[model samples]
Target: MELILLCHAATRAMKTGHFPTGDEPPERDARAQLASLHALPDTRVIASPARVARETAAWIADTFEIVPAFDDIDYGRWRGHSIRETGEREPEHVAAWLADPDARSHGGESVAMLAARVAEGFASIDRLDAGRCIVVTHAIVVKVALAHALRLPLASIYGMNFAPLSSTVLERASPADTWTALNFAPYE
Candidate 1:
């Protein structure tokens, strides 16, 4: 089975440096990126249960099938706060959150939790029914998925950053299967 993980289109919140709450509009560059991804051949299309993710998937598929399991990490009390503001107001929490993969200092989901959720979401997809699927979700979701696919520690999520509309393709024949390729580029 092939899984194409596409981070949601760039949101105005991303460009403006604010935590996204699924209400931001897609930026110009993100629209172009979505158009580029849409040209790929048809496959099963799934999206996280977020407005931004659903809108992004709609760019590539006729129907927007919502996958609640693939939803973005809960930001908790930090939702809608700018990074700078969060850091300034809660420096120690921010520090711990960034340094500890299991830390939920921000009162949100930990990196470990995000990785587990994304892995569970992928595992829930039936390879026999749909061998190939396109999953549109947030950058954090993409990062967590990548860490799971690559068998990296949850902290590795911090070492990687995904751009809007970036795609990471992973494939396996079964639930117990190992990755066949790391960073797959379909167009190339």
Candidate 2:
């Protein structure tokens, strides 16, 4: 099975370094990047329910299944706020969240929770009959999927960068086999 995880296009909140509120639309240039995803015959497309992800998927394909498992990590009170602002207002909370994957001081989903949710998403994808699948989601979701596929620690997410409209490919021989990460690249 082959899986292609594609990050959604850039949004104003993304450019401004604010935690997403799950309602931001793609930036104007997003349409130009639509050419990045070429026509692939017999490919199944799945997307997070977030508006941005859904919109991105719509631009690439006529139809896509909305998957809650691929939803972005909930930011709760930090939503729509810059990371810097959140840190300044709640230094301890920020520090704890960064230091521990289970921390949820922001009253949102923790890193560990996201990892598990992403794992569930992968399992569901594996059950599909399609040989090639594409998932449209957020950068964080892409990072989590990569980390799961590569068997990297959750902390690795902090160091990875997934640009808007970037694609990360993963493949496995079967449902029982371990996944192998193929490549990470942004659509030009």
In order, the Cα lDDT scores of the candidates are 0.77, 0.89
Candidate 1 — which residues are off by over 4 angstroms? 29-32, 39-42, 182-188
Regions of candidate 2 where Cα sits further than 4 Å from its true position? none
lDDT by residue for model 2 (153-173), tens: 999998899889999988999
Residue 154, candidate 1: alpha-carbon lDDT: 81
Candidate 2's displacement at residue 112, Å, is 0.4
* C-alpha root-mean-square deviation, each candidate: 2.5, 1.4
| Window of ten residues with lowest summed lDDT in model 2 | 30-39
lDDT by residue for model 1 (49-149), tens: 88888877877777757987688888878888898899999999989988887889878899888877887787777543676788888888887888787
Candidate 1: residue pairs that collide: none
Considering only N, C-alpha and C atoms within 3 Å, which residue pairs clash in candidate 2? none
Q: For each candidate, what TM-score against the reference? A: 0.88, 0.94
